[model samples]
Target: MASFNEDGLKKKLDDLNMSQQSIQTVSLWLIHHKKHAHAVVNVWYRELISATDSRKLTFMYLANDVIQNSKKKGPEYNREFGSKLGKVFDHLGGLRLDDKSIKGLNRLLTVWEERSVFDADQIRSFNKNFNKDHSKEKSKKRDHSKYESKSKRHKKDVEEFEEIASEPRVRRESELTEHSPQDSTPPSDPPEPEQLIEALQELESAATSDAVVREKIASLPDEVSDVTLLNNLQDLNAARALSQKVEEALAMLEVYNKRLAEEMEARKSVARMLHDYIAYQKDLLAQAEETLEEHRQKQGKVKKVREELKAHLQNLPDISKLPNIRTGGLAPLPSAGDLFT
Candidate 1:
């Protein structure tokens, strides 16, 4: 495990790649140190601000992974990232992003919205900041269109052009053809070995690790639960004191219950992530093995062809040993009259 320090985290951010595995790996690390989530988010934002344009989206993906995955564990990461994401979006909106990058960010926003990762207002704010330039461009285009005037023929042509542009492209013959299951399915991108190890290790000490809370819940005083005992109370003051003790006990139980619920949810979330991760890795491994078999079959065919070609070559008379046709080494001439006789 890397040190839970700003410098170490910065180094990790510096090496981050725009792959799911990379994003998940870093996310797991952040979640593992979620006690320091506030500090982690601060470093993440600072690094994101300073990172290159190409690396910025990757940072956003990392943040999204952490926020979504760690939310069940606790609200620390969610709160920290929620506070900073608006500014991050503001920074991103200022850059000249490509269509792909824009779509990627939009997809993340959609996921966040669909998952209810943030409240409606926060998601709306993020969308506004992220799409500021796009919204402005659309507004400008609308304003421009209002002032434009054209001949009837030109207007018809423009309308036709717009219609054609809006229509979906026809698929090519090859693209329309049926594909095998393997071809239809996208390739899997499994996480690094180290990442899987770390994730498994983190799961070993999951939210259920708090035995103290469990102990406290188990050791509640009997007076709090035994209402029959209240019948024996001799005075109103004693009964009131008993009531106070009962109230305190109830309060403690309520707090512990909430904690337990959170822990249970966190455990379930980790289990889900692990299951998906493991399934993906297994699928990838199977695919790789299938590919390896295919390559081996191809190699065997190539080797057989080479051996056949070698045998055929060896069976042929050597050119050097054969008589040179140009030297006329054999007697071949016969006259027509000699043949008749």
Candidate 2:
């Protein structure tokens, strides 16, 4: 394995525009002793760390090198690198991405992968390790935007459901305000269990209608916040049970929303088809009108010729007064009286 001394590594990384701390953060992932004796400890370690995306690209390139060497020389190259990368990301402090630079990062990885420039096994191992650690941290993770839903353009059903849910909330707010003058009051009752069941049923129906059913189920924890109050109830076990049911319902709703999005897209396609057909028909109609006008002009010319021929026929001499002319016979010699006329 080709190795880099500290100065060589620094120069290479600097040329790639990596900041000092960014180098340090990624350095935590360096494990191939030939390259460097340094080893990584953790991913997020409890504080939000700032690193430009360029640094991450540099990290990925270094990673590709480390992993490739490990595949050919030793498996530890992939093993240690993935373990450290997973830890850092699993507990990621926070990341601010430059959307513009994201394109470059994506392109770099794509080109590298296409060239078979790195060990595919190393990439797979990293992903596997990351997901394993990610699953372990789910319960402790608070920022619940995994698989974030798309824009409202595709969220019709979800938006409608949210609207329905917010109505009773509004009424509760009014009641609270009306009774607020120097008086302590009991909190409003949680909605009836039947209402929850109905909502749950609606969500389940939606889920069944969706194409990506399993993904909807997986993202339920992140999508449902209204149900969390169930966990705070006095009867913890009952609350837990209700929460589970709500979670199931949320999964269904997510599925249904995705189905709705699909339906909307399908409708747009149909609309476009109809529009194109109408335009095509209009073009055909225009061509037909042009053809009709051309035919009319030709018919007019034919009528003029027929009229002239009729006039010529009306002006012809009376053949009954003249000698009969037979086919293939010479015409009668002109009389001397005709020649004089």
Candidate 3:
């Protein structure tokens, strides 16, 4: 942007009046930048607050253009126009929105902002700054967790941040639009059908000179006469309807693909658990089989001892046929009886 004295800046704004297309080009350029975009939006906000413009609607229109760019860009350009709508509300908050039209615009911005995907850090800060009403409720729910050691708490925080970073977040088609549409400038009625057809025909024949193309470009401010212009303004409302539809389909497909990945991961976990369980059962079975085999061997040894004792009893002589042998008397005929037997 050209650095301009106060007069120079006013002249530029004046020159932009007859050219809505120029306003859009300039507006999007400024909004895509951080410091410049905020500065531009703030300038408009100040103008609205101070009522500096003789024609306030003119400034309102420009401001609305800024917001509309952000909305159309959506989260796809989040870094460029981060929290710009919230900045507008910085001044426009509270009872000032009683006007029905302002209320409508405000409602539109609120919806757009809700659909937007903000940075996690910025969101945390916003809630921390503005969510005082919930503080009491949170305090009541607070547990002895605060008493935990500092090291453990730090570890927990690190884990949570890692988990969030690793988590698969699904951004919708709306996420592509960074700015909100504050004022929806109705498209000028297309040139009468006859004139449009003439323009189309003119477009078909190649211009022999850059002079003619430049003349056409410079004439009546500026226009996107071809693919370049259409692509440049694709972030705007009607231009994006088709692209946005395509984006919606892609987002849904992304969510489905992520869900399938998670399901597969869970399946792998269950399979591992089953494998571990089977190995544990096998160990127990082996221990039981070994114990049974030991018991069988011990029972076989005991049977062998019983059989040996029975054989020894059968080998002993009968008491009735044997010669008498008392504790104190001699067995005189033992030898003769043995010989007769």
Candidate 4:
């Protein structure tokens, strides 16, 4: 229920980091306020333009996360970001980026293209704009390297392009393997409060919220458990019908019990996550308090030193009140003989 505005958005961006959790947290915040998608995208683009080169890619990752994840929720973010990406690429094309940054940007573009995040024509347009400068640089390199054999040069160029193009596929595969629940190790960082809340909300009715199912469970016939009632069965057909009813009741109860068990496990997982997250936060708070105490001590020492210096200065003769001696009125130095006497 947190409200979103331009200032809050900027503050979030200013603290944004490359960690997946950090990116996802901010993305969730933005998507939670999808009603302001237009303003959010505009602010996002503006910040991206002003961000240091090191942080620019992080901003793009955030955008990617929001646009892709918000699609199921609504098209607002995707549409808003889509409308601005061409200009974003154009701005990026003008910057003097290192090879790594260039490669990262290329990989993002590749992801968009492969996933059809935008229409083919729009993506093509974005690529053309983004790579305009890079293409020129490559052309110049090709021209300057005319002394090299054509086959060798072509091979080198192809290899470089392939390396960049193949990275997303390799990364995707590694991520899939890394994130498999069966193989996933505990995350190194604590879960954010927002993440824990979202997780708990998912389990709010995980055990089964069907009123009909609960009602059926509550009204289960006593015949299901009353073995003595078998004496009342007048024929094989009656016995068979009662037996089928017992089997059906058993099946329903089994299914509901399984659901309840799963829900229990889910809640336990969330509890573990919350426990870890709270411990982490408490540790951080302790560290912060220690730092504050250290700073307070230092400030006190500095203030004491300043006061002593001020007192020393105040007790000294004021230079301004002292008579100013002209060159002719100044006392002359004594001779070495006078000093001995």
**Each candidate structure's count of clashing pairs:** 0, 4, 14, 0
lDDT of 1 at 58: 75
What would the per-residue lDDT of candidate 1 be over residues 1-341, giving only the tens digit for each residue? 33467866786788788655566556766776788998998888998898888677678777777776666568998999999999999889888765445656787787778768899999999998989887765456557754245233345533432322222122243532343223433222233457667766765555456677667767877777987777788999988998898887789778767766876665544444455456555644664576589889999999999999999999998988877778997678899988999
Which is the winner by TM-score between candidate 3 and candidate 4? 4
lDDT of residue 3 for candidate 1: 41
TM-score against native, each model: 0.43, 0.26, 0.26, 0.53
Model 2, range 1-341, lDDT digits (tens) per residue?
Answer: 22334543443344433332233223322432333433221222211223444355445444544444335445655455545554444332233333222333334334445555445764454345434433434444335554234222335533332222222212243554354322433212122335445544555445345556656566655324664554456787766766787877767776667787766554433333344334434534664576589889999999999999999999999877675566535577899999999
Q: Lowest lDDT 10-mer window, candidate 2?
A: 40-49
Which candidate, 1 or 2, would have the higher lDDT against the true structure? 1
Residue 150 CA displacement from its true place in model 4, Å:
24
lDDT for residue 69 in candidate 2, whole number 0-100:
31
Worst 10 residues of 1 by lDDT: 161-170
Candidate 3 TM-score, true structure as reference: 0.26
The alpha-carbon RMSD values of the candidates against the true structure, listed in the order shown, are 16.8, 29.5, 34.0, 9.6
Candidate 4, which segments miss by more than 4 Å at Cα?
139-341
Tell me the deviation in Å of residue 317 in model 2: 5.9
**CA lDDT of every candidate:** 0.69, 0.44, 0.43, 0.74
Clashing pairs for predicted structure model 4, backbone only: none
How well does model 2 score by local distance difference test? 0.44
Ranking by TM-score: 4, 1, 2, 3
Model 2 pairs whose backbones collide: 28-40, 43-87, 43-88, 206-256
- lDDT by residue (tens digit), candidate 3, 251-278: 6546555655655444433333334334
